[model samples]
Target chain A: MKLRESVIDKSIVQNFLVDAVRKFSPYCPGDLSMATPLIRTGIVDSLTIMEVTKYIESCINTSLPVAKINRESFRTLEALSDMLFDFIKEHNLDLDIDGLKGMG
Target chain B: MDNLGQVLERSINLYPDDVALICSGEQVTYAQLGERVAQFASYFSGLGLNKGDSVAIASFKSIDVVSVMQAALRVDLVYVSLDPRFPPERLKELIRDAAVSVVVLDEFLSQEWSKLEFLPDCIQYALTLHDEKKLEIKSDVKCHNFKEINSDSNDYKRFVPQRKGEDLAYLLYTSGSTGKPKGVRITHDNALAFVEWAASEFEFSQDEHFLNHAQLSFDLSVLDLYNAFLAGARVTLLPEDDAMFFSYVVNLIRDDQITNLYMVPSGIIGLMDKGALMKEAMPKLKRILFAGEKFPVTRLKALLDWVEPNQEVYNLYGPIETNVCTFSKIKTDIVFRSECPIGEAISNAQVALRQDNGIISYDGEGEIVVSGRCVSPGYLNSPILNKSKFFLQDNHRWYCTGDYGYFDKNKVLWLKGRKDNLIKIRGYRIELDEIESHVQDTELVDDVVAVFHGSNSESGAIVLWCVFNQQALDSYGSIDIVVNLIRQKLKSVLPHFMLPKLIKSVKELPKTNRGKVDRLKLKERGI
Candidate 1:
């Protein structure tokens, strides 16, 4: 079923964000958590960030702010989730709830 | 200076205290670099690797990896660079094809160690670049840490090794349409042809600090590494993992005071799109070079505006088979409407367009052929391909570039389109069949056709249309789920850039009248 971007639970969105990094990252030195450094450790680059962004946009059925694709938003899983949640709250766009469940 | 070994030794003698390499804010002087290269060369000789033997270097970008490359050249050993980002299976295939004797791997690749089972049976040893580490592998290949040589006290006095110019220097593997990687064999003379011409033509001196934006595996790095030593100049190494980050790239260029920058156009395009690159940001960047893929004219125009009047932009063009045979200094008044001119052939080479009916024309539209010291002998271990792609005509052997282009009245080259499905995404050469071959290996699909969408710009993407087999049909619930599952599976097996941007389920892919998968039609249908 369809859902408003704001209707999604915060923790669920965070889980999705974490899941995206874990699924796409080539190197996860440790069990990746919300605090794992994505940019500083050189685990994710700009291109990998784009893949993670695309996967999130694929699940949400919407494109993200071009600004959100920067290194700051991708600093960590926590940072990415925080940025996506705030952007979702601001936009309040439509999302395919099932699509979120289907992806990593 | 008949060989690169002489280039290194001469550079060390002439510029002992000058900076040779820089990475991560650490500068390595030519003397220090010479000592490391000599140590590696002596250690490799101790390992019994003869002059003609081929060693494979598989590592992430680092100063040590560059050292190993120079050492291999010092001892007159042929070396091939293996991208650590490639799938382990693909790595094995390349190793087996090249008959790689030993693999110099990065610590990142050795994290889980050889448990990935990527090393082929032919590899006699695996050299991991870490101080102290353990590798877990079931194979008989001996594993050792690189520090074993670096930390040892056995001092072997460095000496120059005189090697023949016709001997093999390195093997570069490119995506072959035949569903396998083809190794292009380059010799010392072939490499010197480009380096000597480039160093003098570009006026590289001890003062020029170069930036290596491409991986060592890519031929684009040839200019980055060789030209520096030839000119007794300094070159900065950019780590492969950090090549995509805007801040890392800009900070390195600004702080390092990089003067000569060589990279694919898409890299700068991405930075410019984010509004990060300013004319004043890199004041020391004097020579801006782009190669590997076409730089869209619109972005090229923007780049011209972004760089100061003193800074020069150049378009360096060549396939891997011919290492940069032609180059053009870009200007505000460009002749081509949508693309930059490839310029006339360099001083060391000649370029001719050959028609299908055995006619070689210097001006008209046809497959571009390069002949001279710049032309590689042929693909290693592929005699059939060597015969077909390279030919002896008019007392010169020419390597036919699969690209169809023409020479204008000014004798400048303009790219029309590819005569094959080979595509370059962000300057990485990829074959449509390469992705399809891997997808077929998954055994989940009855058929698959991969098509490239968009220009070679940042917007470029690969899309795959797959027909599920009976096994997949019974195992999967929906097309969406199946597509997602395939993507996750492919992620572990294909290089990141080669991964399909999208996948779709199909009962059957549409075909053209020739009963071949209609790539053009499918590409148009892709997002």
Candidate 2:
């Protein structure tokens, strides 16, 4: 019943996160950094968060537990990607890096 | 008893010590709220404002703004709610169109107000709330601070004017297809009908803590504000900044123990995405109502699973022209085929489907025609719009809702789509909403919007813009894979001609100010 951890490329995950932020966050500045606070800076509202979360789940192929969708997890692009990576590691799910690029 | 002012007065008399409103950490009892309303009324009277005159209020949602609105109602003045977020030019246009004689606004908006080049000739004075210091205005209009007016001991009993049922209560300006905002004139009776029906339908009581989520300018606030007063229920106003934050909103609801909640589908989806319902049980939350736009079935199912078993959910349907005319209760037993039904008409409204042949149909598709006490008088000062939108047929004044729908076998009304949104692609009639609903049903997609490009002739093509679900993207591992999956799913339900000519994957769809999908913007992008 146990699932094996799937190998994921960190660069691919970072690239996907960048694309999601650029497409979903309309008000987001062009030079948005990985450490930027999307909600606090008004770059993204609740709707954008939903879209971003959905995009993340699709890339990783897993449903995020309610507990992982807090403010800390969604603080920035780095934080969100790290959380997804952690989820992938914990659940032992496989990541498809080439497939992730097509999504981006 | 015919207007909101009377409702507030009744609530004060019935529950003087009960909390009437909580805004920005300030809780006001019914008695205190009444006194402040009276004080504002007296101040307005001192400034020579008379019955039937328009008073424009441009401020954030707060206790002072609520008091000013009630004060205008008490003095029989037409209160015009203006969104302060609007640019100066748009605000000036609305103020000019409303022919407002006075304006009550927050000091924070002083800079923007001063930038306005044109001021309505009727606007003689401006009252600034929140700041004790006087504001320096560049115009000839006189400005007064709230402290100066509130401290006056003048009796307000004599200032209360007798208002008829047909008298103008408020003017709400909504964006029209013509790219201009048209004000909708709602009368005392027009609002009272909806308020009265909602109070009884929801079975609201004095202890009900209702959440005011919509902006004051939006007509949805009519239900949030007046319905609570009609039943002597406490209203908890969500500030504009905090309303944008999902976690903050959930915390507010849990902390305040809000009993009744009203919001648009997008707001509800945001809460669901952030695990608002799953994190903790909102035990005090009794009724959750959504309106303004359609709620995707997948999201609604998630919400239903998250809430308590006994809690009630409703899908209310109506345009700004008529305050909620039809409502559908989201019962646990009812099965949703695609979208939730708009249900039956309210107590004071009648809904009928009018076919293309100018006849009413019970079980087929047609434009929803609403006739009854809740229908508004018509658009303010727009005779052309009034003539086209409002008509008298068979001795009944009916407002033609541009939305298309039909009554099911069980007599429940189901909205199909907007009449204007229907497109003819290569001589094939296609409903944009129908395509969207089918695409949304796909497990791989989170949201979908179908728009038509080009003329109605054979040259036109349909474009399907979709946002893929994270889980699906993860499983498929590529955008091409997700798109292929969606195309395959859509192929079974749609014909070859009805299939999308171009499928574009987007991160998110643009939304209008009222929170509905911004199709006009999508078309403008020519994607």
Best by DockQ: 1
Residue-level lDDT for B130 in candidate 2: 73
Tell me the whole-model lDDT of each prediction, alpha carbons only.
0.79, 0.77
DockQ, candidate no. 2: 0.14
lDDT (tens digit, per residue) of candidate 1 on B455-485: 6647667888899877776778666666766
DockQ of each: 0.20, 0.14
lDDT, candidate 2, A13-80, per-residue tens: 66667777766653455568888765554455555666777777765577777567766777788887
Q: Mind giving the per-residue lDDT tens digits that candidate 2 earns over B1-527? A: 77657888888878889999999889998889888888888788777766899999988789989999999988889999986655455677788888998888786676557666667777788888977678667778899888876556434354555885888899987654443467899999899989889988999887789999888987778888888987889999987656766766787788889888898876777666553655374779988998877777877887887677768999998988898999999986679978888999999998898889888656778999998889999998899989998888778888998899988889999988776765533222345676677677776788888887763323346788888899988887998988766766654444344556678888999999999888778778786
Per-residue lDDT, model 2, residue B249, is: 78
Each candidate's interface RMSD: 5.6, 12.9
- Residue B422 in candidate 2 has what lDDT? 54
lDDT of residue B47 for candidate 1: 79
By TM-score, who's the top model here? Answer: 1
Question: Which one is best on lDDT?
Answer: 1
